[model samples]
Target: MHHWRIDDARQTLVLAATGERLPQVVYWGPALPAQENLATLHATHAIDVTGGMLDANPDLSLCPEATRSFPGQPGLIVRDGEGTPLLPKFCYDSESNGNDLRLIYRDAANGLTLTFIFALDPDTHIITAQTVLDADAPVHLHWLAAPVLPAPQHSGEMIDFSGRWCGEFQTNRTAWSAGMRYRENRTGRTGHEHFPGLIIPCTGATNTQGEAYGFHYGWSGGHRMIAEELQDGRRQIQWGHAARMETEAATQFKTAPLYITYSPSGLNGCATAFQRHLRDRIITWPKPDAPRPVHYNCWEAIYFDHNVPALKDIATRAADLGAERFVLDDGWFGQRDDDTRSLSDWTVDPRKYPDGLHPLIDHVHGLGMTFGIWFEPEMINPDSDIHRAHPDWALGGEDQTLGRQQKALNMALPAVRDFLYDRMSAILREHPIDYIKWDHNRVLPMPDAAQTRGSYALIDRLRADFPQVEIESCASGGGRVDFGILQRTQRVWLSDSNDALERLRIQHNAALFLPLSVTGSHVGPRYCHTSGRMHDITFRAWVAAQRHMGFEMDPRELTDKEATVLRHVTAWWKANRDWMQRADILRLDSADPAVIAEQQLAADGARFVVFAGKADTSAQIAPRPLRLTALDPNAQYLISLANQQDIHHLSRGTPALKSGPVTLTGRYLMANGITLPWSFPDRMWVLEGKKL
Candidate 1:
């Protein structure tokens, strides 16, 4: 028997080959002893398809199937040239290179070959799998998945997310059931409605208790994630790029890798694994150690009113409030006063800046802040010059549906990709622009593989040419949040909505899989333009400070008191952002449903910060004690309020701070917890703790 098992630091993946069939995962969970073999496990754990099977070995009961079964979705689907399903038998051969594993299977009838690639990050306990197909003869490919694995047992609760526009990354949980639960996004881009990941926690598991497993689809385009429980109590979770092909040459194609990890320590354990994998392997930060700049965007300030004098005034005021980057949003190019026209033109609007953006750029630089600009390079307005010149470049044709009055460019076309790359590259060469807020406001009407590949190619080309230019991925906000895009861009605008209260839930859920350093959080105006909710400036700033801090308000309208609060928040962020960047994030469980608590513990066990906010509190005067986590039990810590001044008039007898810089042992803090001040709705508090 030819079998293999790969062991990461915490888990083990066991694969076995039985005769001519492709190898299947027999076990994936907490590591077994080093001397354990797959034969013993398979004899005891493999599904028994003895006499009750129609196909002898029932396909539905198999661990991984090449085609769909009654129990779950197929991991691979392909058809032939004449529109017939190509169900081929497997011919297996295996090999290994370093720590990576490769298993080859051939279909002699269809002249096609499939290879399953597997690798594990020894440190993070992340298992990666990818599927590749090769064919010598003409074959029409339908759909191909990365890889699929089945759970040993069907006892757990499924956790996922759903949201829209300004309200993204809303968490949802459901008990494991027999029927299939599928979440899919066909919006061309990863829509804000659903995330491309799933978490399955063992029955009755808490944030830090029991066992949990995470499955993340690495593709950034349209995707499908499914969790199904079979009649026999076994569960299967599968994910892959959601692409359809009627009849195309199947010479070679590879599905994006799907990442899987198991955590005995529950949700927080899974989160830590994902964060480490992203920061260490996925995101390529320009300055990983340096703090992200506090940006002040001009979109809300003077939308489409792009004049040099007005922008200069805003920039000056933003700098006075410690904004290190000033971004000029939409309406700066070719007749782009509104969303209707001039998207792909990529030229500075002469009417807005007669001197070709130089005066505004210089003014921003003179204010000691980096200059940034916004662009929707992959979209074209029908009224713009680019569309007029290349009407056929639009995806789904010009006659199809339009979003935000704009159509997506056919990124798969070499001509279109080159055009976008050249035009965006030219802008970088022409000016001292330090950042690019790449926004994709529309979704693709059809799932064209070219669009995703092409968009990625264009961004890659631009980044390779201008290494200093930082890019933010904004697909109508939180629409393109994934490891694939994060690989090319520095940060993501978590959502378009700047309502602080809404942002708390959005940021909290997103931070589960993404590092706060790569999430773009902004302090919007007092009256949120999206939600129309008015929040205090201090409340807004405190929430934004938890991530890559920025501001999306007009500084010219700020009151003197508001300006002082903004300045203090920015100063405090600059002083503590280093710890926030590298800390291990932990979302604490609260007995009260109204309160959300999050903690960031420094890697060295020296410091940590906790952010507690309430959307709505009960009538009870005293809130439950907030237990802190991820601290060294032996060490002592000194605690203080991040915002010492009672900006919101917090109750005087708050348990978090009863005296000046109260000191407590980490063991006590983790076990006993602390109480928070009673305040009105939408109130937040930040507590900082330093090892003593």
Candidate 2:
């Protein structure tokens, strides 16, 4: 028997193999003593045989083999060049060292080699794993999962996500069953409907307590996830690209990295690990030491109306309101007056700016704000010049249904990719552009792995050439957000709906996986364009401040009072952004169902800010005390309500929090919780606390 173990401060993972067979992860959980025997643990991990089963249980190795009669879904599915299915049984070959483990397996008869890579980040406590397959000759890949991991037996339910265009990250909790809980996103992008994340919580786990396991597939393309429970009561999870997404035969195939972590400190532990890993390890920032600038995107303000004087005026007002970056969203290219035409035409509109984009770019620069331009590179409209010139560049059938009046470009074609690169690179090279609001407004006609790889190639090439520029992934809003895209881009436009009420809920749920630093939340027009809901400037500004603060509404329409409120909020956000950007967003469990609250605890445990948003009226008349997390029990904290001036007339009661700053022990704050004055629906209370 052979055994290996990987350990960090928070968790442990042990793998074992018998004879020459591939290894199976025998044990994984909270950290054990360094001197513990892994071999004995592996031996103790075995299960007994029963009727209707084989005399001896087959090891559910890293890549479960059909030849071994494994009951659940096989990890790898492939075919030969002539389309004959091939079941390659891999055997132990070799291993590597260091912080990462590379386990090599070989199938001599099939001329195939398999390698599973595992790396655990000591700082963030995230385990990153991937599987690579190599063959002597071309083979078609149907499905190839990352290193498979076992699910917790004590967990009763799992939480996945399902959402729409504006409503992203809505959590769906389902009970564990005898079979599989399968989910597949085939939109050809990391879809809005099915976010590539799963959280399995132990029976009584909450946001701030209990043990939980989190899994996220980092691929931006279509992906399939399986959380299965065998008849033997063992559970396993597998993540891979959508089945048969590979179009042509190939000699090599690789699964995207699967990021998993065991959270002893509940769901927030998983969230913080992912958050730190993404912001610190995945993203390559252009300006590392620079603070996150406040963004002002002119999409809702003036869609497709690119008048130079009007834009210059808006830029000036936005800068005056504390915006440091100005993004020129869509409608600057081709003859694009509307969404229907001119998607692939990457040139500046002559009618909108006859002197090209220089006049507007120069004006934005004069306003003391960096300039960003928007592009939909992976899509082309039927009325576009590029489509007219090369109809074959479009993906799928000619009669396939269109989304947002646009068809996806055949990114798999080098000719198509070269054309897009030439056009977009010319703009980036010529202009003093520092940012690109990269948008994918439509889904591909079909799910093809080649299309995603080609898109990734284009972005990678662009990033390498213009290393100073930042890119944001916005797929009609929240459609293409994942670790794969963030690996290249700096930020994500969280959603299209800027209604503070809706945003309060969406952002709360999304915090389970995303951090505040990479999430873009904007203060929309008083009348939200998508939802038609009107919110106060106070509520809007505070909600936007929860993430990468920005504004999408027209500055010209802001009332004097509203402008003052926005300015103060923006200033406050800037004052604390350095620490808040690195803070762990801990979701507070509010006794009142109507309140959605969270606490952003600084990395050093010195200070924290709690945003308690009253999303709706409470079922009970009085407000419930909200609890905070991750604080020293004996330490004393001075707490004060930051937005007390925004209190309404109805909130006349003199709650201790509203009266003045109060000092309380962390034990009391976590147990008795903080009480607040009653507020109306769609309102929010901000509390700032510091440890003494």
Candidate 3:
């Protein structure tokens, strides 16, 4: 349970608790208010959020997040001398978040006391708790890695990038690094298993007089976050293990459907700022229990040029394998084969679908699956009818029209917005398209190719009018990804690159800013798109960790063994979905070749730790120290599992098990880890440590 209080100005809702505040997130703009001066928060896995107890937009007023604190407890009802206890503390050291609320419990229990600072729009705040349970109904005791830091305070209406932050010591753990040191694999592209996308950059060292200890990274939007080193060179990022839950916003007059505000402050202020911008940013799902689709796409198997029947065959096979959704890639749209013309058609190709998309969709639906189509609405081809119809709507001059793919559409015009709106809406309303893979293929072009107020205004307009539909923003991959789109779309296509190695980097890089829920990742078989570098099929499958997961391959192309493995893996993922969503992600590897591995567990002690030794595959017999402080100190559990070779060569190609808590002594776990008789196996392997 989470609680909050607003300040006297009723703007910032000071967060009281949120465990280990290292949550990487992105934001689009200020919240939209339906009524006046109230905000509403949301909880996932729940049925619905639309009810009588909510508002449209909350006030995203400026408040101190880093330099502030919210004083309160979940079950404690201590009131102000004369009134109710406000969530926002009168005095603040900096922006604060829900981390304080979480740490309160930890501190009370003698566990490590974690602290986080953040700012929210005066209107609303949201807290999401890890409600995942183990297969047996117990919570897996997962390890927490992200650290909490002060939310930057930029001089703006809404907090954005401040560029620099100070004030550490207050949280006072006094462990880890002493000064500030930047993390090498901030993007997590190392292709390691156990720690695929961990971006916990900066180690704390002693800082001497605040002499530049903070490091910065480029954000998709103009927004960015900073991790400053204090007088002691301790490197810390913004608020950690984000448990988002904020107050409900009151109704306000309607303006825009949703409005996202960018602070010169950067992305760190997003959640806190969300408090103010809650009302309109609220996207009520038509069906609360909308099962996140189990999907397979053609992009990986056949890129943009894949023919319709090939795609349909892929869809048919995918459906047979329990996939619920099928998405058609490019090439299917307009005269898109060579990217020369036909984009404006927005119509199905005659030769491809003969009977139009309805038939292809019918075929997919007939197989008891939902159909999805990909579209690049904000773009237009030079040879397109719409572009030729209104040449003035395009951004470039005579013949020099920027052609990232054919001629790009100039989205900066109201006419363009209307054109896209009418075309897209009509398609959705008329088709059996249950899902849409909305993509934005190219960057904004040398910056100013658009004739209107640049791309920002265009995006804003499209977002405002494009509704009742699911949209995804793709920048020829992950280039233009940001929170702005998240405010309007259901998910963002993470990247065009699908190679597992590339994904290991891309996903990690993207997760540094966006939440896992919105990052669409496909388990590509072998390897496709991103270099086509093939590793092992199972190794590729291992990359899926509940982030809107799916695949982009021809099911028919899978080997018998590969298919069996995929089926088992998918089943396991769904079974463990709770843990993946609710627990803290502890990524253990750096993408470097010499050393890389990944280990993630849920509440009760169940974890998936994979070690893809990159350096000397010289197997070590020394028991690896498996951290177990996240679990009960005295409770002993058993270890179960074996490497691929051990399973195949020794036990009829299945996991081996043993009884013991993998054996631990004192407060630390003994390293009796993998006793590999050989070097890192060239083949993919798995080791599930079952609790004894």
Query: Each model's TM-score, in the order given?
Result: 0.96, 0.99, 0.58
Off by over 4 Å in 2: none
**Model 3 RMSD, rounded to 1 decimal:** 16.8
Best by lDDT: 2
What digit string (tens of lDDT, one per residue) describes model 2 on residues 351-430?
99899999888988988899999999999999999899999989989889999999999888999889989999999988
Question: Which is the winner by TM-score between candidate 1 and candidate 3?
Answer: 1
lDDT agreement of model 3 with the native: 0.42
Name the top TM-score candidate.
2
Candidates in descending lDDT order: 2, 1, 3
Off by over 4 Å in 1: 48-63, 66-71, 152-154, 243-247, 647-656
What's the lDDT for residue 631 in model 3?
Answer: 37
* Runs in model 3 lying further than 4 Å from the true structure: 1-288, 304-308, 397-403, 446-468, 525-529, 589-595, 601-629, 642-667, 670-692
Candidate 1 lDDT tens digits, 313-399: 999999999999999899988988888999899887888888898888899999999999999888999998988999999888646
Candidate 1, after superposition: displacement of residue 126 in Å? 2.0
